[model samples]
Target: MEGEAGVSVPQRSRTGLRTERLLLRQWRAEDREPFFALNADPEVMEHFPATLTREESDAFAAQSEADIDRQGWGLWAVEVAEGPDAGAFAGFVGFKVPRFDAHFMPAVEIAWRLARWSWGRGFATEAAREALDFGFTHIGFGEVVSFTAVPNVRSQAVMRRLGMTHDPDDDFDHPVLPEGHRLRRHVLYRARSAA
Candidate 1:
C-alpha cells in the first residue's frame, strides 16, 4: 500500500514485514534455536542433500542478517500472528540473488523455508506473496524466479500459488551442488511483476 501517495504501511525495509497471518521480518536472538532445528530437520532438508550443523545454521543466520543489512532485502525471518503458534518463530521467505551461474544468471529468486509445524498453514505462500509484492510494486523488479529439485512438489505448489509458471526449457543443473547429486537438476519457475 505504500506505493500510493499517503497510503500507509512502509515498504519492507531491512527490518521486516507483516502479512495477514505472518511476519516476514528480521532475525531475533530467540530465533536461533528453532531456526537451527528447522534447518537440521531431515524432512525439512529432504530436497537438499543434507541437514546443516548448528554452526552452519548460525552461519546462515548471520549471513541472512548481513544480506538484508547490505542489500536492503534478503530472506526474512517469519513469525505467525495470534494463535497457539502466535509470536512463534515460523520461518523465512523473501528475495535473494543466487550466487552461481546457470542459464538463468542475474535473476532474483523468491524462496521460503518454514519449520515443520508451519507447514499446511499457508504461511509460506502468505509471506512469499508479501515479499513478491515488495519486490515488484515497491522495488520495481520486472520478474522474479524460483527453482527447486524436481521432486520438491510442495515448494513447486507454493510457487504455482504465487502465480509463477514453470517452463521445462529453463531447467538446469544447480551449479553449486556437487555433480551427480540427485537434487542438482532443478526446475525453474518465473513470475512477472505485479506492478
Candidate 2:
C-alpha cells in the first residue's frame, strides 16, 4: 500500500514488520540469552549509564513484548530474515515512547540496538527505515524523533542516513540522568511525516 508520503508501505503483521533483510517482530524465548549479552557488552552499552544485568535485560525484553502485545507495536526484536544467519536474533529496532518529560516528551522515538556482529552492515539503518515508515503510515504519527549522547556519532549517523534532521536548539539534558553526567546532554534528531 502507498503511504501518505507516496512511499510503498512495508508488509506488517500484528507485532511484526519485514524489511528487505531483517524481520522486526515480537521478542522470543530464544532471544533472551543473546539480548542479555548485548545489554551486558560494555561496548554496546557504552553510550548508556551502565550495562544491564541479566535480570534487567530480561525485564526490559518482557516489557517490550508486553508493549507490542498491547499496542501492536513497540521495540521489535530483529532477526536476519535471509542469509546464513537467517532467523538468528540480531537485536532490536523499533519505536519507544520516552517515559520522562522533556521538551520532546509525548513523542515516539525511532531507535535500535544491534549486536556487535551486525555493525558495519546496513541493518540498523534498513530496519529503522521500515520502523519509521510504519510509524508515519500505520501509526499516523506526524513526526518521530531520535536522540543520543553527544559522543554517539554512530547513532547520529544512522539518524542522518534516515533523513532525520538535527538542530542544536532542540538539544536537551536528559531528565533521567543526573546533572553533570557525561551522557546527560543529548542531541535530538527529528523526522517529519511527508503527509
Candidate 3:
C-alpha cells in the first residue's frame, strides 16, 4: 500500500484541497488495492448495483486519474491527513462531470466513495465541504449537484448537510439504469456556490 497508507509529510496534489482531518490529494498508483477493497465491500457498494471486479475497479481509478490530469480536477483520492487513520487512503471526495445526458447535462457534481471504516466519522462531509468550496470559489462553478437512489438516505443526508436543496421536480429515473431497476429512480439535489 506504498502511497495508499497515510503519509504525514503533507502530500499535496495538483488539485490541492485539504480539510482539517483529510487531504483531498491526487490519485496515486498505490491507491489501487484500497480502492478495490472499497469497491468490493458489499455494504459500501449497496447503493450501487454490484461490486466491481479488481480490473473494473482499476479501470475506474485510471479513468478518475485521467480526469484529474486532463481537467485539473476530478474526484480527489483522499487520505486521512491526521488522527489514527492518518496516511491511510480513506477514499475519494471531489468534483466530476457526469457524461450521461439528463436534465442536468452541464452541471458539475460533488461525489464520494469512501472505505467502510471511514464511514462513521465526518470524513466525507469534511472533505466534501472543502471540495464544494474549491468548486465554487476556485473553479468558478455556479452550482454543483448530487444524486442517488431515493433510498440512499446516507448520501442524501450528506447532501442536506452541505446545504443543498432538493425538489421533487428534480427527481429522475437514472438514464444509466434499466427501466425497472430498483436504483434507477434517483433523487437530485443542488447546491449553489457561496460566491
TM-score of each: 0.91, 0.93, 0.91
Task: Evaluate model 1: give its TM-score.
Answer: 0.91
- What is candidate 2's lDDT per residue for 1-195, written digit by digit as tens? 443323444446354889988999989999999999999999999999999999999999999898777666779999999998898899999887888989887888888999998898899999999988888877777889999999999999999999999999999999999999999999999999999
Candidate 3: residue 186 Cα off by (Å):
0.3
Best by TM-score: 2
Tens digit per residue, CA lDDT, model 1, 1-195:
332112233445666877887877778888899999999999999998899999999898888877776666788899887688788998788888888988888888898889998899888888899888888776667889999998999999999999999889999988888899989989999999655
List where candidate 2 sits over 4 angstroms from the true fold: 1-15
Compose the digit string of candidate 3's lDDT tens values, residues 95-159.
Answer: 88887989887778899999998888988899999888877665667789999998899999999
True-vs-predicted CA distance for residue 188, candidate 1, Å: 0.3
Check candidate 1 and list the clashing pairs.
Answer: none
On a 0 to 1 TM-score scale, where does candidate 2 land against the true structure?
0.93
RMSD of 1: 4.1
Q: Whole-model Cα lDDT per candidate?
A: 0.84, 0.89, 0.84
Off by over 4 Å in 1: 1-11
Worst 10 residues of 1 by lDDT: 1-10
Steric clashes per prediction: 0, 0, 4
Predictions ranked by lDDT, top down? 2, 3, 1
